[model samples]
Target chain A: GAGVSQSPSNKVTEKGKDVELRCDPISGHTALYWYRQSLGQGLEFLIYFQGNSAPDKSGLPSDRFSAERTGGSVSTLTIQRTQQEDSAVYLCASSPRQYQETQYFGPGTRLLVL
Target chain B: GESVGLHLPTLSVQEGDNSIINCAYSNSASDYFIWYKQESGKGPQFIIDIRSNMDKRQGQRVTVLLNKTVKHLSLQIAATQPGDSAVYFCAETAPLNAGNMLTFGGGTRLMVKP
Candidate 1:
């Protein structure tokens, strides 16, 4: 079966620019999550979406970070006015259902803000 | 805020030998734990998971052990191989009522020598 997939494996942009990272979760998956991994750091939870429930944005570092899942499938993570500190790998994961322990991850999109 | 952390930043082991990675989480309320492996340029891949009710679980060549008393978790790989070299992370999550977000540890870089 096809696993999670992300677009733009690598992205280099200037500071203050905006970038959108896409994620396609596996078919039938109802839970989706977005995470950020800084160089040599652990994964940081960003946002989560489950079915039609309200998304969890508590982990988002700032208001510039936001994500939306349309039709309960694909998700897009948008970072407005990107900053140098936002230069990191944005990863997406999904599970079969909410509260599922195992999450399948995508290849990720590496973003570099100059 | 409570967080998960790894006991060691790096671990080196000879191929064919057993390898063990340790983690500690501060949230005692967390009931679910998972182990993930990430290569140099990829997102995390789920290896195995264990729930609070059970102390251990095994999958293929990987085994996950949980100690609720000490808030400790460990991943043991049998006959470690070069392909197993990667950054291993342990994550913990509360129950559905509390929250579904996973708190990941810093991660342990496993270096396998053939």
Candidate 2:
């Protein structure tokens, strides 16, 4: 079975630039999540989407970060005016259901803001 | 703030030995726990998960144990192999939350010595 997939495995951008990371969730998955992994740190929850419900944006670091799940299948995480602190791996995951379900992850997009 | 954390940052064991990774969570309301393994250049892969109702769950060569009373979780790998060397993370989620967002702990780097 095809797993969750992400695009732009690696991205390098200048400070203050905008970047977009894409994720393709597995077929039939209704829940998608975005997370960030910093060096020597744990996975930080970023945003979440379940079906067509309002996405949870509480985990996002700041106003510059936003994500949209289109048609309940694909998601795009956008960071506007990126900062050096945003240099990290952006990971995506999806699950069959929203509650207490095993999540499949996609190889993250490593973003580097210089 | 409540969060999941690992006691040890790294562990090394001989090949074929049994390895156990421990995690401590602060949210007593958490009812689901999961373990994930990540290689150097890859995203995290689900290893196993255990519900608060169960104390343990086993998968192929991995076992996940959850202790709701103490807010603790552990992942044990039987006959650990070099291929198992990677960073292991434990995550928890409170099913009551609508988002069911997972809070991940600092990863434990497992090294299997040949």
Candidate 3:
């Protein structure tokens, strides 16, 4: 792809339902990151992936929130038992070769847990 | 902990005036910094970046200044315009072994009034 790509630009789900958001990073990018942006709030770090490593999952908000990257290309973020507080925009980014290198962002997926 | 996407303190500037956005980073080891601009419903776009080795860097109508001594960073926009109204984010980069990863600061919103 020409840039980082995220899917399902907008979503509205019932409370307690599970939702999965997808991300397709730029080709050959080695670092991928996930962030949550709430209304009028700062972007919150959610998770990070470096190549095929264990990933830096320190930012995951809870047990119900999880993410995974396959073959170092595509990724998915799953939120189980969605809550109203979970409504926000999920942003994904990826950098070429290194982590601190420039990270290109995606359009993001906006989720609304009703 | 390093983060990005600020709660967004806002700065309003009249058209043809200049706007300055400020940030403070927590990591002393972070030497590389980049500024991003995000419009409503859009992902952030890279504005400018400065290396720790340099105190300043300039681009078309935009400049980024780094004060490592104070752990502060600022973005200056010359001749502000209504199109410049957007949220600005400052990010710091840390060397992580073979890669460098960015930790973002809270964002600041710039409103250019015509």
True contacts kept of each: 0.73, 0.88, 0.37
Residue-pair clashes, model 3: 8
What C-alpha lDDT, on a 0 to 100 scale, does residue A85 get in candidate 3? Answer: 95
Q: Interface Cα RMSD for all candidates? A: 1.5, 1.0, 2.5
The prediction achieving the highest lDDT against the true structure is: 2
Per-residue lDDT of candidate 3, residues B1-114 (tens digit): 444333338898899998888888877888788898999998878899888999999999999988889788889899998999988888877775224545666688898888
lDDT on C-alpha atoms for all candidate structures: 0.92, 0.93, 0.84
**DockQ for all models:** 0.72, 0.85, 0.49
Best model number under TM-score: 2
Preferred candidate (DockQ higher): 2 or 3: 2
Off by over 4 Å in 1: B96-99
TM-scores for candidates 1 onward, in order: 0.97, 0.97, 0.91
Tell me which of candidates 1 and 3 scores higher on lDDT. 1
Candidate 2 lDDT over residue span B1-114, tens digit each: 888999999999999999999999999999988899999979999988988889989999998888878888999999999999999999999956558788999999999999
Which of 2 and 3 is ahead in TM-score? 2
- For candidate 3 chain B, which ten residues in a row score worst on lDDT? B1-10
Candidate 3 deviant stretches above 4 angstroms = B1-8, B96-101
Q: Which lDDT tens digits does candidate 1 get at residues A55-83? A: 98888999999999999999999999999
